[model samples]
Target: MDKIIKTSKTIRAILKVLFWVVAVVSVVILAAILVALFMKGGTALDGGFSITLGNYSLLLNQEYSSQQLTSLHFMTFANVALFGTLSCYIIRVLLNVFEPMSQGKPFSTTISVALKKLAYAILIMGIINLVLQIATNLIFYNVFDIPSLFNADRVESCSISIVSDGSFIIWFFILRLVGHIFKYGETLQQLSDETL
Candidate 1:
């Protein structure tokens, strides 16, 4: 019993460290991405990479007027049902495995600690996507409402060009998909339990 407790304690400690590390890294990376985006989008972002800080207003520029940004955003949202289904459908289902981890003795000792790690990740991504959605919408509705916000002076979510990059699109899809997969796992576990 003592050994099991110690092992669980160690795993919990490791998980705590890993969780904070992931959270910190996520924040830092997000900040850097915002900074980079600002630099690339506006006058405030014009310095060297190390000192680079550009205009936040440029986000309103529809940066890909010449590219496919508009279509990409449309595709992402238009297929949100598909995206949601494909991305988060079963990710949460597997969470039941850990549900017992909280109470000590679980239905399946076979559940790997890795599942905990993965569930942690999916939760984060789901939250981040929700936050990003809200933030972008606020920027569109409020931030861009200011007359001087943009160089060319535009106000629309479609006017924003963050979606212009294909790589960014791919990255988002990957994150969303992983989150969904994890959610599906959690959900399936729940549904099975309900039937049983």
Candidate 2:
């Protein structure tokens, strides 16, 4: 019993550190993206509060049509897909992270910790992406005096403002639900250990 308790605490501490490390990496990656955007798009990119704030004619019109897109539209679509793929990949890792944690095995605790943190980091970034999307869209519509190509009513809605707000909430909440389940699974593991 004493050995088990000690092992659990040690593992938990290691996992906590692993979580922070992955979170740090995620932040760094996100910062790198912002830096790249600034480097390429320039300081005007910083003047936000509107989607149309910048080159609305250029970015929005460039949407991926049946024909291949040429410039920023293609880039924008690719970015969305890239983020989605990354999120799915991270979610897969998170699912695996549960196995070791559920079994309370020390064998892959380190890997599990890393994956869990990575999943969290990716999920947070996804959420942030959604927020920025919605915000820029709002600024585009309201401030910049351009229409949202996505949806008129949806964009016009007052309540849901986050780039990923409203419908995105419904969609991503499913992922959030999975996260909560994983969280509860961890809690249950702790509880069972106490029971034992």
- Which prediction has the highest TM-score against the true structure? 2
Q: How many backbone clashes does candidate 2 have?
A: 7
In candidate 2, stretches whose alpha carbon ends up further than 4 angstroms from where it belongs are 1-72, 98-108, 131-196
Q: What is the lDDT of residue 164 in candidate 1?
A: 24
Tell me, by lDDT, which candidate is best. 2
Candidate 2, residues 104-181, lDDT tens digits: the string is 553343443544456456556667677557644544344333454457856654333443334444545555565556
Q: Residue 77's C-alpha lDDT in candidate 2?
A: 43
lDDT tens digits by residue: candidate 1, 1-196: 4555555556655655655555565456545544444343334322231211254323333223212223333333333433343233233333333344544543343354434444445554555455556555544444324444435545443232233223434554565565556566666777888999
TM-score of each: 0.29, 0.31
Estimate the overall C-alpha local distance difference test score of candidate 2.
0.50
Model 1 residue 49 CA deviation in Å: 14
- Return model 2's CA RMSD, one decimal: 12.4
lDDT of 2 at 74: 37
Per-residue error for 33 in candidate 1, Å, reads: 0.7
Candidate 2: which pairs clash?
Answer: 50-139, 51-139, 51-140, 52-140, 130-164, 133-163, 134-163
lDDT of 2 at 188: 70
